[model samples]
Target chain A: MISIRELHKSFGPLQVLTGVSLAIESGKITAILGPNGSGKTTLIKSILGLVKPDRGVIQIGEQVLNGDCRYREDIGYMPQIGHYPENLSLNDVMTMLQDLRGGKHPTDTQLLEKFRLGKEMDKALGTLSGGTRQKVSAVLAMLFNPKILILDEPTSGLDPVASSIFKDALIEERAAGKTIILTSHIMSEVEELADAVVFLLDGKIRFHGSPTEILQNTSESNLERGIARMMQEAVHP
Target chain B: MRTTGKIIKYEIRDIARSKFVLFYFVFFLLLTEGLLRFGGGSTKTLISLSNVVLLVIPLMAIIFGAMYLYHSREFTELLLTQPVNRHQLFRGLYLGLAVPLALSYGAGLGLPFLLHGFNAEGDVALLLVMIGSGIFLTFIFTAIAFWISVTYNERVKGLGFSIVLWLFFAVIYDGLVLLVVAWFADYPLEKAVIGFTILNPLDLARILLLLQMDASALMGYTGAVFQRFFGSFWGISIATVALVGWTAIPFWLGLRRFAQKDF
Candidate 1:
């Protein structure tokens, strides 16, 4: 479980996160939905300790995430763009991660096999297509079998088959009781895997509850329409 | 230390795999060997090579180091999310970068010297000084570039700053120093001149190389004064210390910025 309290972050005049406090429970895929420039990525990065919050506190389980970085051991983060050293092949990336992570623990290679990255491990990251690179990112995120996985735009570049494969993997991880916090613009994907939903707009949490609740409140049947309706209210309000 | 080692291992692996370092290695080897082969008067060629090192090494270090740090940023960000110390990560990266540059400078220029018959009293000390100064410049400028990369959010801005920094030390600084000295001709400015030279790593490196080559005639008024003041051993020591200081301070500043920076 992760808890953030009164987190306020600003980039110059633009306030990305404004007094947003959230507690994400374990064993659920919490899909953080937001519009462009809505601070969803900032919020996620803040939790991953990638973006330092200007104010407030974050706690993972019971330990306060301050200057100590050891807690990040439990986190596997798949960055949005997944830029890596262009010279290095996929195997080099895997080895580099293994080395940087230090000490040998059990690593999940299932995702690698699922993506069939083993055959293409010799290919340099620069040569890979965007979707392939995303698959690499996904594999790295799931490899460590971290208790918390923070995936940014997890399926943006994936093909239908790869995306479905990824979704199935997420479901499996959820079944294994891992806390998954993912940000995606894809509502159908969110509808498929997200156990609970957290909607953010203008650096504030607009809605946080079950997907059905959002549908009921907005008088819509499906998630896409419900979210659209919610956005409509925001625009008018 | 173990984690630092592991990081360095992978980091070096990454750098070595890149074409940048390899290109550097080949360029230096061909240039050095080519000079040795065609250019008559080995000593003159060595002196000219020293001049080349003085001008080119710092520039290469700045461009390469800045580009590497900026490009490796995504890799750095990914590592940030892992359970690793920032200080160690930076130290590892610093060493990872510095080591290859040093090795390439050594071997590229070095193999030529060995092939041409190296000696302790003959051309060996001069070659050693060239290699040493080259290494120092690499470390110093790379540290500066690292600072630039970490301190700026935008890569273009960071690289721009790095270029300006390289220009200031390599070209502009000496001209400005000459202008200042000429302006203050009536003032007792030897100490001030030496102080200003110490402030710039390229100047310090130039002095080290020039003195090693015993070509102080080319060093101008301050070089003679520098020789008189510090003598040989003390001069080398002071210059070496200055170069070390230049390397350490910027790297430390860069490390501090990196530790505090958000991805």
Candidate 2:
């Protein structure tokens, strides 16, 4: 389980996250839903220790993040726009990452085979298409069989088929008792996959519950309408 | 330590594969070869090579180092998410850049001189000083570039700062020193001039090589004063320490900032 308390962050005068306290349970899929500039990425990055918070305590399992990086060993992260070394081929990148991670764990190449990326492994990352690169990101995220998976917009550039493959992979990982946190704009995807939802607005958590609770609270039939209603209410209220 | 080594290995491989680094190697190789072939004899060639090395190596190291940092930001971000210590990563990145550039420079100049044998013992000493100065300038400027790159997020700003810094050290600093000399012509300025030279890494390097070459005669009255001060064992030791300071101060500052940087 991962927990954060009183998390705060700012870029210059622009505040990105404010007093965000959240506890993400293990063996579940949690979706962080927020509009643009709502601090979802900042929150995620803070948890990953990529962006240091101004004030907060983040604990992952039994380890507390006090500027130590070993906590990230159990976590796998997929960036929204995966920017890798342009000169390295897909195979080279994979090998380099494996080498960096120490190759101590038994590797998981299921997603690599499932996405049929072996044929394109020799191609340079710079030359690959967006969808192909997204697939590569997905493959690397699961390669270590990490205990926690944090995916930022995991399906943005994927085609319909690739998207389904990715969603299935997420499901399989969740079923295997891994904690998963993902951010997405696709309501249908969230409705289908997310076991819990945390809605953030203006750098604060406005709502956190199951999809049914959010729908019932907003008096809406679908997850999209419920979130829209919440956004509208916050803006006008 | 092991992790730092792995990071350095990957970073060196990445830099070595770039066409620009290859171009840098070739540019130095050809320039050194041309100077050796047509530039009169060994002493004259050494003089010309020192001038070129003193000017070009700093500019190349600063510009290339800053540009490489900016270009590889994505890869940097990717690494940050992994289970790697930031200090080790920073050291790896810095050394990965400095080592190859320094090697290329040393080899580029060293190769041609090896082919054309040294005529005199003094010529051999002068050549070593020139190569040593070039390597020092490379490390010093690359560290400064890393500091600038880390401090500024915008590429244009970081690059502009790097170029301006190079211009200051290579050109403007000399102009300013000359102006100071002209203004203070009536005063005893030998000690003051040495102090000013120590302030700039480029000047320190130039004087180190020029004093070794015994070309202090061309520098007028000040040259004799410089030879008296800088030609001694104590003078050389002081200048070497200053060069080391030039390389360390910027790199230390850059590393501190890197550890605190959000990205």
Candidate 3:
């Protein structure tokens, strides 16, 4: 479990996150939803320790994040855009990361085989298509079998077939009792995969509950319409 | 420490494969070879080479360092999410960039001389000094460039600051010193001039090499004062310390900023 309290962050007079408190449970999938500039990415980055919050307490399992990076060993991250050294081949990148991570854990190559990335491992990352690179990102994130998986827009560039494969992988991971957090714009994808939804607005958590709870609260038939109604009520009220 | 080494290893490999680094190595190789082949006696060639090294190394190191950091930002963000210490990551990145560039420079300049052979014992010493100075400038300027790159987010602004800094040290600083000397002609400016030279790594390197070449006589009265000062053991020690400080201070500052910076 990852617990955060009173998280605050500002970027040069612009407040991106303000007093965000959340507790992410294990053995479940949580989706963070927000409009652009609503601090969803900032919140995620803060948990990853990529962005240092102005004031907050972030505890992962029993360890509190106080500048120690060892806790990150249990977490896997897939960025929205998988930018890598242009000249490094896919094999080189994978090996380098494995070496850095110390290879202590039993290697997980399920996604690697599923994606059939072995054939393209010799290709330079710069030469790969966007969907292929996204697949590479997905493989690296799952390679360690990390306890927590944070994926940002994991399906954006994927073809329909690859997307399904990715979703299945997520389902398997969740069933294995791993905590999964993801952010996506596609309501249908979130509705399909997310067990709980956390909706952020202007740096604050406006809603946090299961998708059914949001539907019942907003009296909407679908997740998308419920979220839309919530946004409208927040702006108009 | 092991993690840092692993990071450096991959970084070096990535940088080594780039066309720009290859071009850099070749440019220096050809320039050094051309100078030795046609620039008259060994002494004259060495002098010309020192002039080229003083100007070129800093410019190349600064620009390349800034550009490399800016270009690899996304890759850096990717690394940041890993279970790696930020300090180690910064050191790895800094040395990874500095070491390759420094090696390309040293090997490029040294290879031609090794093939040609040194005619005199003094010539050997002078060549070492010249190459040493080039390596020092590379580390110093790369560190400064890193500081600039970390401080500025925009690519154009970071790159522009790098160029302007190179200009100030390589060109404008000398002009300014001359102006200062002329403005205070009667003020017994020898000590002040040495202090000014110490402030600019380029001048310190040039003067250090020139003193070794026995070419200080060509620098007129200021050269005489420099010879009296830098000719001594203490003077060389001080200059070495200054150069080391130049390399360390900026790197420390850059690391501090980088550690706290939000990716």
> Taking the tens digit of each residue's C-alpha lDDT, what string does model 2 give over B123-203?
988888888988999999999999999999999999999999999999998889889999999998999988887899998
Q: What's the candidate order when arranged by decreasing DockQ? A: 3, 2, 1
Candidate 1 residue runs with Cα over 4 Å from true position: B34-42, B118-122
Candidate 3, residues A24-111, lDDT tens digits: the string is 9999999999998899889989999999999989999899999999988888999998898887887887788789988676768899
Better of 1 and 2 by TM-score: 2
Per-residue lDDT over B176-252 for candidate 1, one digit per residue giving the tens place of the 0 to 100 score:
98999999999999899899889989888888877777767797766777788899888889989988999899998
The 10-residue segment with the lowest total lDDT in model 1 chain B: B113-122
Tell me which of candidates 1 and 3 scores higher on TM-score. Answer: 3
Model 3: per-residue Cα lDDT over B1-263, one tens digit each:
99899889988877877777778888889988898888765677787888789899999999999999998886688788889999999899999999888888888988988898766678888888888988999999999999999999999999999999999998898888899999999798989988887798887777668677786566545456777876746666777788988899999999999999998
lDDT of 3 at A211: 98
After superposition, which runs of candidate 3 have C-alpha atoms over 4 Å from their true positions?
B220-223, B229-231
- Runs with alpha carbons beyond 4 Å of true place in candidate 2: B219-226
lDDT scores in order: 0.86, 0.88, 0.89
Q: What is the interface RMSD of candidate 3, in Å?
A: 0.9
Q: Lowest summed-lDDT stretch of 10 residues in model 2 chain B?
A: B215-224
